[model samples]
Target: MHIHFIAIGGAVMHNLAISLAEQGHQVSGSDDQIVEPSKARLKKANLLPEQVGWFPEKITEDIDAVILGMHADINNPELVEAQRLGIRIYSFPEFIHEFCVNKTRVVIAGTYGKTTIMSMVMHVLKTLDRAFDYVIGAQLEGFDSLVKLTATSKIILIEGDEYYASPVDHRSKFHLFDPNISLISGVEWNDSRTNISKEDYVNLFETFIETIVPKGTLIYNKESTILREIVEQTFDCKINRHGYKMPEYSINKGVTYLHDGDYRIPLQVFGKFNLSNIAGAYTLCEWLGVKRDDFYKAIASFKSSIRYLEFVASVNGSVVYQDFLFSPYKLRTSIHAVKEQFPCQGLVTIMELNPYDVINENFLPQYASSMDESDHAVVLVNKESIKDKNIVLDDLEQDIKRVFKHKDFVFLTDLDALEGYLESFKSLGFNLLFMVSPKHNTMNIVSFADKFFKNF
Candidate 1:
């Protein structure tokens, strides 16, 4: 098979290209911009385009399929050419569904912890030598790529995203998977452009549940009242429902241990949220016929996904962490996790208003008390980003101030100013918690912190 990826520089697109290439399919791809990791990985696979920009001439009928990325606009020349030539074009999710159609699809969906939970499932399965393929959002520690597809694998684990599949396909990416087994980590309204109203935002998941095959399972976090209500109202009887509560546990000397009756297993990862993720992973593995004893042993070796709560450095008595938190629910959960882990420390939480949903004036109020758990909060928003997105900064700031109700909290528009503020407080011995989505400014927080803390 021959596959050509349009806008292949995307995180998922590049991985899919490599997966196909590794599967002995002739693969070629073109993108306007190819950044690090993706660029280097494509180069290593000898799949990177000789030239960066798309070429209509490259989209010949000889190509078996053209995988379109969400990054590619509807007006993309190669996409247009592919359509003109009557070539089949599949969105990334659509292509993945085609590959896993025969396999038992295990789709993990949520507003938060999807990547971590997916990674956990993959890790446990891999350790057990289970023949499975998977598509995860982030790069895992031992995984060669973000995606893997093979003829022999009987199961395919997918980190289900709620974002629009493509410019032409407005349906949520998760909807395409049509899962035989699914898990909803939690739900919070996200993707501003796709889901406008609260009801509309939630209806997607309801529809997702409805799509499950008969005798399939839908495992969900029992803590989310809204999600549970949706399941009760919409899920069909054939779809077996399972609910999970946060496992009983305690952290001793910075190490987290899950206590299930008399059994005690120490975990490499910290936080109540991660503990819950592990519980959900264990339950899913058990449902897949993994023995409880084997599940615990395999999970004991598990490390967390990158950037979920990655440690930066510990200077003096204060430590700093970089967390991938964007949604209001994630913000609240992450803050609570950090504070609970270090109760004696003064928590200084800094988050970048980077997501389109969080930056939009209409959505700012949704995050009103998201950071209330933190002792000191700093909200950072890039002014240029707000202007480019046509969002009002005053509206965001006003709502944040009203919701946080913390006089010590400060809102800043400049990264340099935020860095300066951190530098000045170097001697304050405060534990720093930085949360942001993948944005131009948020991506640099680690570099800034490294430089600032090294000198301090």
Candidate 2:
């Protein structure tokens, strides 16, 4: 079979192209810009487009199917040609579903902690010597690609998001998975582009819960009032609901230990959110027939996906960590996790309002009490981004200061100012925590961390 991708350079799309190629399919793809790992990975597999731009001539009817990335516009030239030739088009989620339709799909969904929970489950599965296909959003430690597909694997793990499946397919990506087993971490309105109101966002998850297969198992976070309320309502299908909260755990000398009846298993990962993540993963893995003891044994070594609470450097009783936390829920959870993990040290958090959605003046209020856990918090945003998004920083600062409950909460829009502020903390001996996100400019973070840590 021949499959062409309209925007194959996307992180997930490129990995899918590689997966399909590995499956012995003739896969070809194009993108306006093919950058870094995607370019190298595709080139290694000889699937990278010979040229960067799209070619209508390549969209011949001989192509069995064309997979569209969310980055591709509906009117992309190759897409237009594919439509003219009456070729079938599948969005990324659609194509993924096509391959995993026969497998027992286990999807993890939520506004926050989905990646961590999915990574936890994947780590345990791999450690337990299980064979499975998966498509997680982050690059886990042992996985080469963000996605993996095999014809033989009977089960597949997927990170389900409420964002659009594709430009043409306006439905949330999670709706397409039709999971036999599903996990909802929690629902918080993250992307304004997808759902403008809180009701619409909550309804999206409600719709997702209904799409589960008959007698499906839904593992959810019991702590989420919104998710709990939604799941209690009627659904057409007879589904099993299992809700999870933080397991019994204690932080000893900056190391998190999970308690069994008598044995305490030390974990590499820390934070209450991660503990909740572990509980959700344990529940899902248990349903998959993994022994509780074996599951905990494997999960003890789980380090989580890259860019999530990654230890960057340690200097003079101060440590710096990096995390891909952007939304209010993520920001608050990450901050609390660090403070709880190292109760003795002062936590100085540098959070970049890196995602465009959170940069909005209207969305600023959601972050009101989110940063209250931090001894010192800096809400970092690019000045040009504020101009591009038409956000009034002066007004946003008021909301941020008010919500953070700290009169001294700093909002830095300049790189130099941010660097200067971070440098001043060099002598303060506080734990430096960076909360960032993708699709946002994070170079400043790298540069600042490198410079500050190198100075010590």
**Ten-residue stretch with the least lDDT total in model 2:** 187-196
Instruction: Give the Cα lDDT of each candidate.
Output: 0.83, 0.84
Scored by TM-score, the top model is 2
Residue 155, candidate 1: how far off, in angstroms? 1.6
| Best-fitting candidate, scored by lDDT | 2
Instruction: Show pairs that collide, candidate 2.
Output: 368-403
Tens digits of per-residue lDDT, candidate 1, 138-160, equal: 78988978888998889899999
Counting clashing residue pairs in each candidate, in order, gives 0, 1
Candidate 1 has a TM-score of 0.87
Q: Which parts of model 1 are misplaced by more than 4 Å?
A: 75-77, 190-194, 355-373, 382-403, 410-413, 426-429, 447-456
